[model samples]
Target chain A: MGKKVLIIDDSSTMRKIVTRSLRQAGLDFDTILEAGDGQEALQLLAKESVDIILSDINMPNMDGIEFLRQKSANAAIKSIPVVMITTEAGADILAEAKSLGAKGSIKKPFTPEQVSEVLGGLM
Target chain B: MSWETHIADATVEIFSTMLMMEVSSQPPLTERIKSHQDSVTGMVGMAGLYKGMLAIHAPSQVAMTITGNFLGLEVDSVNDDVKDAMGELANMLAGSIKAKLSDNSKDIQLSIPSAVCGDSYSLDYQPQQGSSMVPFESAGGRFLVELQLEQQT
Candidate 1:
């Protein structure tokens, strides 16, 4: 079976950028899914199965931290690994995300090499 | 160094890394330019330990060029994509400034990003503490990045 990936962010522009970056990084996924926010991502998760997830920390409705919290509680989607791609680079928030079972992170204004370096192992 | 240095470094880094464009920062402006014409302004607010706003103002054509570089497409108008791209730039710039202000992420809270655009408009802000506006030159044109900050007790 081909691998699938999910990307969650509030900005449609950012979603498109992430999709482009993924292609540039050579991280090929047979299927690529998108969600506007954590709530939307959770709803999408209930219906679709993805091997990994890339998300943004700040968003409307449901942020990434809360999404991680909610995703952990659901047995069906708990196992899917999540990597945050956000403007936030503070130790506190990133640490909290790590505690919540995030696999890794890629900071905003990041390069394709940075994306590949962090997500290469996760994939 | 100073806030000016931070703003310059952050803006340059973002444009270079994300936009794949090189931008050179000019000396800081002595006075803030409140009124804009044929331009788009993207901004974000910060509150808590420090209260402030970070904004990026660009001409319509320059903004379209930026959006084009960002998405690898030709954007001829200042549409939703231009607004979102500019807002995201402000968000990223604010995040960099926030990191410099405090180590704790909760120490400061950032509002959702917003954008304004038109043939003519003015942003009215009376900052109680400090303010700085830096101009940058890109291949397409020039833009300004403004920071208005006041430390809270």
Candidate 2:
């Protein structure tokens, strides 16, 4: 079976774009699930098993950093690598996310090749 | 590159790469308003190091075209899809410009994007000491990107 992936972003349009980009990048995934924010993603994780996560940093509730903090503390879901796709241009934020155990990050206006390159090793 | 150049470049790249539309910068307009009667505006605010607002404004028709191209579907009018697409564009543009600003952008915090649509409306960045409005033309339509920064205390 192909790996399962979870995509989290508040914007449905962005979620669709990320999904399409992932497919275009030729990532083999059997199923792709989506959530609007980190809080919702946590709820989804409670029931589903996903190999990797693609998330956005700025969201209405439970931003990516806090979500990562919570995820890191949980033994069950801590190992699932998360790749942040966000428009946050702060190097400090990026460093903070990396310190929190994010596998990688792809900035906005990114290409499919960039997405594939970032997630290839992790996934 | 200067902030104006960055905004122009990012706008073109986003439209070209994401929406598959070709866009070129137009001369700066004295009046910030560049949209037609019916238009949509996407706005995002930045805080911390560089406090300001970034906005994208497009006529309803242009918005529909962008929405359609982004979603890979034919959109006949302005709807949730168009608003969402515009908001996403604003977010991406702010982020792209933030990156180009180098270390000065390290502490900047971006607000969630907000959008508005109407036949006639006005936005004032009052109390803002510095601002830049850049216009671009795609095909036959014109849209704008404006950056307003708060005056340093």
lDDT of each: 0.93, 0.86
Put down candidate 2 lDDT per residue, B60-95, tens digits, no spaces: 998888888888889997888889999999999988
- Clash count for each candidate, listed in order shown: 0, 0
lDDT of 1 by residue, B2-21 (tens): 89999999999999998999
Model 1: docking quality category: high
| lDDT for B28 (candidate 2) | 64
DockQ of 1: 0.84
What TM-score against the true chain A does chain A of each candidate get? Answer: 0.98, 0.97
Instruction: Give the poorly placed runs of model 1, Cα more than 4 Å off.
Output: none
Q: Candidate 1 — what's its lDDT?
A: 0.93
**Candidate number achieving the greatest TM-score relative to the actual structure:** 1
lDDT digits (tens) for residues A36-106 of candidate 1: 99999999999999999999998989999999999999999999999999988889999999999999999
